[model samples]
Target: MHGLVNRCIEVFLRSTYGNALWQEVAAETDVHPDGFLTWGNSPDGVTRSIVIASARRLDKSAGELLEDVGAWLSRQEQIRRLLRFGGASFEEFVESLRELPGRVKLVIPDLELPGFAVLSDARGRYRIIAESHQSGLMRVMAGMLRGMADDYGSLVIISVARDRIEIDVVLPDYSGRRRFELSPMQVRP
Candidate 1:
Protein backbone atom coordinates (compact mmCIF):
# COMPACT_ATOMS: atom_id res chain seq x y z
CA MET A 1 0.00 0.00 0.00
CA HIS A 2 2.77 2.43 0.92
CA GLY A 3 4.65 1.74 -2.29
CA LEU A 4 1.53 2.18 -4.39
CA VAL A 5 0.68 5.52 -2.77
CA ASN A 6 4.25 6.77 -3.00
CA ARG A 7 4.45 5.88 -6.67
CA CYS A 8 1.16 7.61 -7.37
CA ILE A 9 2.26 10.82 -5.66
CA GLU A 10 5.53 10.79 -7.51
CA VAL A 11 3.70 10.61 -10.80
CA PHE A 12 1.61 13.71 -10.13
CA LEU A 13 3.95 15.83 -8.00
CA ARG A 14 7.57 16.56 -7.39
CA SER A 15 8.03 14.70 -4.12
CA THR A 16 6.24 12.45 -1.62
CA TYR A 17 7.40 12.74 2.00
CA GLY A 18 9.88 14.27 4.46
CA ASN A 19 11.03 16.81 1.91
CA ALA A 20 11.15 20.60 1.87
CA LEU A 21 7.89 20.75 -0.01
CA TRP A 22 6.19 18.67 2.62
CA GLN A 23 7.64 20.90 5.28
CA GLU A 24 6.25 24.01 3.61
CA VAL A 25 2.82 22.44 3.25
CA ALA A 26 2.91 21.48 6.91
CA ALA A 27 3.74 25.05 7.82
CA GLU A 28 0.87 26.29 5.71
CA THR A 29 -1.64 24.04 7.49
CA ASP A 30 0.10 24.19 10.89
CA VAL A 31 0.56 20.46 11.39
CA HIS A 32 3.18 17.79 11.05
CA PRO A 33 2.90 16.43 7.51
CA ASP A 34 4.53 13.16 8.54
CA GLY A 35 1.95 12.35 11.23
CA PHE A 36 -1.83 12.57 10.94
CA LEU A 37 -4.87 11.39 12.86
CA THR A 38 -7.99 9.99 11.29
CA TRP A 39 -11.26 8.95 12.92
CA GLY A 40 -14.47 7.52 11.52
CA ASN A 41 -17.97 6.68 12.65
CA SER A 42 -19.57 3.23 12.62
CA PRO A 43 -17.88 1.16 9.93
CA ASP A 44 -18.92 2.96 6.77
CA GLY A 45 -18.37 6.65 7.48
CA VAL A 46 -15.10 8.57 7.19
CA THR A 47 -14.95 11.77 9.19
CA ARG A 48 -11.84 13.16 7.53
CA SER A 49 -9.85 13.05 4.30
CA ILE A 50 -6.31 14.30 4.36
CA VAL A 51 -4.71 15.27 1.06
CA ILE A 52 -1.02 16.06 0.93
CA ALA A 53 0.19 17.92 -2.17
CA SER A 54 3.95 18.37 -2.16
CA ALA A 55 6.13 20.22 -4.60
CA ARG A 56 9.86 20.83 -4.92
CA ARG A 57 10.97 24.08 -3.35
CA LEU A 58 9.65 26.08 -6.25
CA ASP A 59 12.19 28.58 -7.37
CA LYS A 60 10.15 31.63 -8.24
CA SER A 61 10.31 35.35 -7.83
CA ALA A 62 9.00 36.82 -4.60
CA GLY A 63 6.12 38.18 -6.65
CA GLU A 64 5.17 34.69 -7.72
CA LEU A 65 5.20 33.32 -4.19
CA LEU A 66 3.14 36.26 -3.02
CA GLU A 67 0.69 35.62 -5.79
CA ASP A 68 0.36 32.00 -4.68
CA VAL A 69 -0.14 33.08 -1.11
CA GLY A 70 -2.85 35.48 -2.18
CA ALA A 71 -4.61 32.84 -4.20
CA TRP A 72 -4.63 30.40 -1.32
CA LEU A 73 -5.98 33.02 1.04
CA SER A 74 -8.70 33.99 -1.37
CA ARG A 75 -9.67 30.37 -1.98
CA GLN A 76 -9.99 29.66 1.72
CA GLU A 77 -12.45 32.52 2.24
CA GLN A 78 -14.26 32.61 -1.10
CA ILE A 79 -17.12 30.17 -0.40
CA ARG A 80 -18.36 32.07 2.63
CA ARG A 81 -18.25 35.42 0.92
CA LEU A 82 -20.10 34.10 -2.11
CA LEU A 83 -22.76 32.43 0.02
CA ARG A 84 -22.91 35.49 2.27
CA PHE A 85 -22.11 33.16 5.14
CA GLY A 86 -25.86 32.55 5.27
CA GLY A 87 -28.45 30.38 3.50
CA ALA A 88 -27.30 26.82 2.88
CA SER A 89 -25.50 25.40 5.93
CA PHE A 90 -24.21 21.90 6.46
CA GLU A 91 -20.67 20.68 5.86
CA GLU A 92 -18.43 23.33 4.31
CA PHE A 93 -17.59 22.77 0.64
CA VAL A 94 -16.53 24.98 -2.28
CA GLU A 95 -17.31 23.70 -5.74
CA SER A 96 -15.21 24.91 -8.61
CA LEU A 97 -17.57 25.05 -11.55
CA ARG A 98 -14.62 26.38 -13.51
CA GLU A 99 -11.09 26.97 -12.28
CA LEU A 100 -7.59 27.11 -13.65
CA PRO A 101 -4.17 28.27 -12.64
CA GLY A 102 -3.67 32.05 -12.15
CA ARG A 103 -7.23 33.03 -12.89
CA VAL A 104 -8.07 36.16 -10.94
CA LYS A 105 -11.85 35.71 -10.95
CA LEU A 106 -13.92 32.53 -10.74
CA VAL A 107 -17.33 31.94 -12.27
CA ILE A 108 -19.59 29.87 -9.97
CA PRO A 109 -23.18 28.74 -10.56
CA ASP A 110 -25.51 27.37 -7.92
CA LEU A 111 -28.88 25.64 -8.26
CA GLU A 112 -30.80 24.34 -5.29
CA LEU A 113 -30.57 20.55 -5.34
CA PRO A 114 -30.58 17.34 -7.38
CA GLY A 115 -29.13 19.31 -10.28
CA PHE A 116 -25.87 20.78 -11.59
CA ALA A 117 -24.42 22.77 -14.49
CA VAL A 118 -21.35 23.52 -16.58
CA LEU A 119 -19.13 26.60 -16.61
CA SER A 120 -16.68 28.08 -19.08
CA ASP A 121 -14.36 31.07 -19.19
CA ALA A 122 -17.23 33.48 -18.46
CA ARG A 123 -17.26 34.50 -22.13
CA GLY A 124 -19.63 31.94 -23.63
CA ARG A 125 -23.06 30.48 -23.19
CA TYR A 126 -23.48 28.45 -20.00
CA ARG A 127 -25.91 25.52 -19.77
CA ILE A 128 -27.67 23.93 -16.82
CA ILE A 129 -29.21 20.50 -16.29
CA ALA A 130 -31.43 19.88 -13.32
CA GLU A 131 -33.66 17.42 -11.51
CA SER A 132 -36.32 18.09 -8.91
CA HIS A 133 -35.72 16.60 -5.48
CA GLN A 134 -37.68 13.40 -5.03
CA SER A 135 -37.65 10.91 -2.16
CA GLY A 136 -36.28 7.97 -4.14
CA LEU A 137 -33.41 9.99 -5.60
CA MET A 138 -31.70 10.88 -2.33
CA ARG A 139 -29.34 7.92 -2.35
CA VAL A 140 -28.45 8.48 -5.97
CA MET A 141 -27.66 12.14 -5.40
CA ALA A 142 -25.67 11.28 -2.28
CA GLY A 143 -23.67 8.76 -4.23
CA MET A 144 -22.93 11.20 -7.04
CA LEU A 145 -21.70 13.92 -4.68
CA ARG A 146 -19.68 11.48 -2.61
CA GLY A 147 -18.12 9.85 -5.62
CA MET A 148 -17.11 13.07 -7.38
CA ALA A 149 -16.08 15.09 -4.36
CA ASP A 150 -12.69 16.79 -4.79
CA ASP A 151 -10.75 18.30 -1.93
CA TYR A 152 -11.60 21.79 -3.18
CA GLY A 153 -14.81 21.46 -5.15
CA SER A 154 -18.55 21.65 -4.39
CA LEU A 155 -21.70 19.52 -4.20
CA VAL A 156 -24.82 21.20 -5.58
CA ILE A 157 -28.03 20.62 -3.64
CA ILE A 158 -31.32 21.38 -5.39
CA SER A 159 -33.50 21.41 -2.27
CA VAL A 160 -32.99 21.09 1.45
CA ALA A 161 -35.46 18.26 1.99
CA ARG A 162 -35.12 15.60 -0.68
CA ASP A 163 -32.18 16.33 -2.95
CA ARG A 164 -29.22 16.52 -0.61
CA ILE A 165 -29.61 14.75 2.69
CA GLU A 166 -25.89 14.30 3.12
CA ILE A 167 -24.23 17.67 2.41
CA ASP A 168 -23.79 21.15 3.90
CA VAL A 169 -25.24 23.92 1.73
CA VAL A 170 -27.07 24.62 -1.56
CA LEU A 171 -26.77 27.90 -3.41
CA PRO A 172 -28.67 28.92 -6.56
CA ASP A 173 -26.86 31.07 -9.10
CA TYR A 174 -27.68 29.64 -12.48
CA SER A 175 -30.25 31.13 -14.81
CA GLY A 176 -33.86 30.09 -15.55
CA ARG A 177 -36.46 28.62 -13.17
CA ARG A 178 -35.64 26.47 -10.14
CA ARG A 179 -37.66 24.54 -7.59
CA PHE A 180 -36.05 23.93 -4.16
CA GLU A 181 -37.54 20.62 -3.18
CA LEU A 182 -35.35 19.12 -0.47
CA SER A 183 -36.21 20.04 3.10
CA PRO A 184 -32.70 19.94 4.59
CA MET A 185 -31.77 16.58 6.08
CA GLN A 186 -30.63 16.46 9.67
CA VAL A 187 -26.90 15.89 9.85
CA ARG A 188 -25.32 13.04 11.75
CA PRO A 189 -25.18 13.43 15.52
Candidate 2:
Protein backbone atom coordinates (compact mmCIF):
# COMPACT_ATOMS: atom_id res chain seq x y z
CA MET A 1 0.00 0.00 0.00
CA HIS A 2 1.08 3.57 -0.55
CA GLY A 3 2.17 5.67 2.38
CA LEU A 4 -0.44 8.23 1.49
CA VAL A 5 -3.17 5.74 2.35
CA ASN A 6 -1.52 4.87 5.66
CA ARG A 7 -1.05 8.53 6.49
CA CYS A 8 -4.71 9.18 5.77
CA ILE A 9 -5.72 6.31 8.04
CA GLU A 10 -3.51 7.71 10.83
CA VAL A 11 -5.02 11.14 10.41
CA PHE A 12 -8.53 9.74 10.30
CA LEU A 13 -8.07 7.77 13.54
CA ARG A 14 -6.38 10.65 15.33
CA SER A 15 -8.95 13.22 14.26
CA THR A 16 -12.00 11.09 14.86
CA TYR A 17 -10.95 9.21 17.98
CA GLY A 18 -8.15 11.44 19.40
CA ASN A 19 -4.42 10.92 19.83
CA ALA A 20 -4.76 8.83 22.96
CA LEU A 21 -6.99 6.28 21.28
CA TRP A 22 -4.74 6.26 18.24
CA GLN A 23 -1.74 5.52 20.41
CA GLU A 24 -3.56 2.69 22.09
CA VAL A 25 -4.82 1.30 18.79
CA ALA A 26 -1.42 1.62 17.16
CA ALA A 27 0.19 -0.21 20.03
CA GLU A 28 -2.39 -2.96 19.91
CA THR A 29 -2.20 -3.24 16.13
CA ASP A 30 1.60 -3.20 16.19
CA VAL A 31 1.67 -0.24 13.84
CA HIS A 32 4.42 2.28 14.19
CA PRO A 33 3.62 5.37 16.24
CA ASP A 34 6.38 7.25 14.47
CA GLY A 35 4.09 7.72 11.42
CA PHE A 36 4.29 6.58 7.80
CA LEU A 37 6.50 8.23 5.22
CA THR A 38 4.33 9.97 2.63
CA TRP A 39 6.39 8.77 -0.35
CA GLY A 40 7.11 5.32 0.96
CA ASN A 41 5.15 2.08 1.01
CA SER A 42 4.08 -0.32 3.73
CA PRO A 43 2.90 -3.91 3.80
CA ASP A 44 -0.75 -4.34 2.93
CA GLY A 45 -1.13 -6.33 6.17
CA VAL A 46 -0.31 -3.22 8.16
CA THR A 47 -3.42 -1.43 6.89
CA ARG A 48 -5.56 -4.52 7.43
CA SER A 49 -4.26 -4.90 10.96
CA ILE A 50 -5.02 -1.29 11.78
CA VAL A 51 -8.51 -1.60 10.38
CA ILE A 52 -9.24 -4.80 12.28
CA ALA A 53 -7.85 -3.40 15.51
CA SER A 54 -9.78 -0.20 15.16
CA ALA A 55 -13.00 -2.11 14.48
CA ARG A 56 -12.50 -4.24 17.59
CA ARG A 57 -11.67 -1.26 19.80
CA LEU A 58 -14.62 0.81 18.61
CA ASP A 59 -17.04 -2.12 18.73
CA LYS A 60 -17.94 -1.50 15.10
CA SER A 61 -17.81 -3.59 11.97
CA ALA A 62 -14.72 -3.20 9.81
CA GLY A 63 -16.86 -2.00 6.94
CA GLU A 64 -18.48 0.65 9.12
CA LEU A 65 -15.15 1.85 10.40
CA LEU A 66 -13.84 2.04 6.84
CA GLU A 67 -16.88 4.01 5.83
CA ASP A 68 -16.15 6.54 8.53
CA VAL A 69 -12.53 6.62 7.45
CA GLY A 70 -13.58 7.30 3.88
CA ALA A 71 -15.94 10.04 4.98
CA TRP A 72 -13.19 11.59 7.05
CA LEU A 73 -10.81 11.24 4.12
CA SER A 74 -13.18 13.16 1.88
CA ARG A 75 -13.01 16.08 4.31
CA GLN A 76 -9.24 16.19 4.54
CA GLU A 77 -7.48 19.06 2.83
CA GLN A 78 -4.78 16.76 1.51
CA ILE A 79 -7.33 14.46 -0.13
CA ARG A 80 -9.38 17.40 -1.35
CA ARG A 81 -6.32 18.93 -2.95
CA LEU A 82 -5.38 15.67 -4.64
CA LEU A 83 -8.94 15.13 -5.86
CA ARG A 84 -9.31 18.71 -6.97
CA PHE A 85 -6.39 18.19 -9.28
CA GLY A 86 -8.80 16.12 -11.42
CA GLY A 87 -11.61 18.67 -11.62
CA ALA A 88 -13.32 21.69 -10.10
CA SER A 89 -16.91 20.40 -10.00
CA PHE A 90 -18.51 17.37 -8.36
CA GLU A 91 -19.52 15.85 -11.68
CA GLU A 92 -16.04 16.27 -13.01
CA PHE A 93 -14.53 14.81 -9.89
CA VAL A 94 -16.76 11.74 -10.10
CA GLU A 95 -16.04 11.38 -13.76
CA SER A 96 -12.35 11.61 -13.13
CA LEU A 97 -12.48 8.83 -10.53
CA ARG A 98 -11.77 6.23 -13.15
CA GLU A 99 -8.33 7.69 -13.63
CA LEU A 100 -7.39 7.55 -9.99
CA PRO A 101 -5.08 4.55 -10.23
CA GLY A 102 -3.16 6.20 -13.00
CA ARG A 103 -2.94 9.39 -11.02
CA VAL A 104 -1.66 7.50 -8.02
CA LYS A 105 0.95 5.84 -10.16
CA LEU A 106 2.26 9.25 -11.13
CA VAL A 107 2.94 9.99 -7.47
CA ILE A 108 3.84 6.52 -6.27
CA PRO A 109 5.20 4.63 -9.21
CA ASP A 110 5.24 1.22 -7.52
CA LEU A 111 1.95 1.37 -5.71
CA GLU A 112 -1.02 -0.73 -6.82
CA LEU A 113 -4.37 0.98 -6.68
CA PRO A 114 -7.90 -0.14 -7.45
CA GLY A 115 -9.80 0.38 -10.71
CA PHE A 116 -13.06 2.19 -11.47
CA ALA A 117 -15.55 2.28 -14.33
CA VAL A 118 -18.50 4.61 -14.87
CA LEU A 119 -21.55 3.48 -16.80
CA SER A 120 -24.66 5.52 -17.58
CA ASP A 121 -27.96 3.88 -16.84
CA ALA A 122 -31.08 4.26 -18.92
CA ARG A 123 -32.71 6.00 -15.96
CA GLY A 124 -30.02 8.70 -16.29
CA ARG A 125 -27.99 7.65 -13.29
CA TYR A 126 -24.39 6.50 -13.10
CA ARG A 127 -23.12 3.11 -11.97
CA ILE A 128 -19.53 2.93 -10.80
CA ILE A 129 -17.84 -0.44 -10.97
CA ALA A 130 -15.06 -0.78 -8.41
CA GLU A 131 -12.59 -3.59 -9.01
CA SER A 132 -10.10 -4.60 -6.38
CA HIS A 133 -8.33 -7.70 -5.21
CA GLN A 134 -9.13 -6.76 -1.63
CA SER A 135 -12.54 -7.16 -0.08
CA GLY A 136 -14.66 -4.48 1.75
CA LEU A 137 -12.95 -1.54 0.05
CA MET A 138 -16.13 -0.78 -1.87
CA ARG A 139 -17.87 0.06 1.38
CA VAL A 140 -15.37 2.83 1.84
CA MET A 141 -16.04 4.01 -1.72
CA ALA A 142 -19.72 4.32 -0.90
CA GLY A 143 -18.99 6.50 2.10
CA MET A 144 -16.54 8.59 0.15
CA LEU A 145 -19.14 9.23 -2.51
CA ARG A 146 -21.64 10.27 0.14
CA GLY A 147 -19.09 12.62 1.67
CA MET A 148 -18.29 14.02 -1.77
CA ALA A 149 -21.97 14.73 -2.23
CA ASP A 150 -21.91 16.71 0.99
CA ASP A 151 -18.76 18.50 -0.13
CA TYR A 152 -20.39 19.49 -3.44
CA GLY A 153 -23.68 20.47 -1.84
CA SER A 154 -25.42 17.93 -4.00
CA LEU A 155 -27.92 15.28 -2.95
CA VAL A 156 -27.06 11.75 -4.04
CA ILE A 157 -28.36 8.23 -3.51
CA ILE A 158 -25.83 5.38 -3.58
CA SER A 159 -26.50 1.67 -3.83
CA VAL A 160 -24.34 -1.38 -4.03
CA ALA A 161 -25.11 -4.52 -5.99
CA ARG A 162 -23.33 -7.86 -6.18
CA ASP A 163 -20.76 -6.73 -8.74
CA ARG A 164 -21.34 -3.02 -9.36
CA ILE A 165 -22.09 0.14 -7.41
CA GLU A 166 -24.56 2.81 -8.54
CA ILE A 167 -24.80 6.47 -7.63
CA ASP A 168 -27.75 8.72 -8.44
CA VAL A 169 -26.86 12.38 -7.99
CA VAL A 170 -29.71 14.82 -7.57
CA LEU A 171 -29.26 18.23 -9.05
CA PRO A 172 -29.98 21.44 -7.22
CA ASP A 173 -33.45 23.04 -6.75
CA TYR A 174 -35.22 19.67 -6.26
CA SER A 175 -37.31 20.53 -9.29
CA GLY A 176 -37.75 17.65 -11.73
CA ARG A 177 -35.69 19.38 -14.39
CA ARG A 178 -32.16 19.38 -15.80
CA ARG A 179 -30.85 16.01 -14.67
CA PHE A 180 -27.08 15.62 -14.80
CA GLU A 181 -25.78 13.96 -17.94
CA LEU A 182 -22.70 11.89 -17.17
CA SER A 183 -20.70 10.67 -20.14
CA PRO A 184 -19.91 6.98 -19.90
CA MET A 185 -16.27 6.33 -18.99
CA GLN A 186 -14.26 3.14 -18.74
CA VAL A 187 -10.63 2.91 -17.63
CA ARG A 188 -9.29 -0.59 -17.17
CA PRO A 189 -5.82 -1.88 -16.39
The TM-score of candidate 2 is 0.79
**Clashes within 3 Å, all models in order:** 21, 0
How close is every model to the real structure, measured as TM-score? Answer: 0.19, 0.79
Q: lDDT for each of the candidates?
A: 0.30, 0.72
* Candidate 1 local distance difference test against the native: 0.30
Q: Model 1 residue 26 lDDT?
A: 51
- Supply candidate 1's per-residue lDDT for 37: 33
| lDDT tens readout by residue for model 2, 83-185 | 6566555667677888888998897777777776778764437888766444456777777877777766667788865446688777722333222223213
lDDT, model 2: 0.72
* TM-score for candidate 1: 0.19
Error of 2 at 56 (Å): 1.7
Residues 1-189, candidate 1: write the lDDT tens digits: 122222222222223234556456556645445533321111111100113223224554322332233233233333224332222322222234222211322331221133443322332222222245343224323333332232224334422233334243233333332122233243212
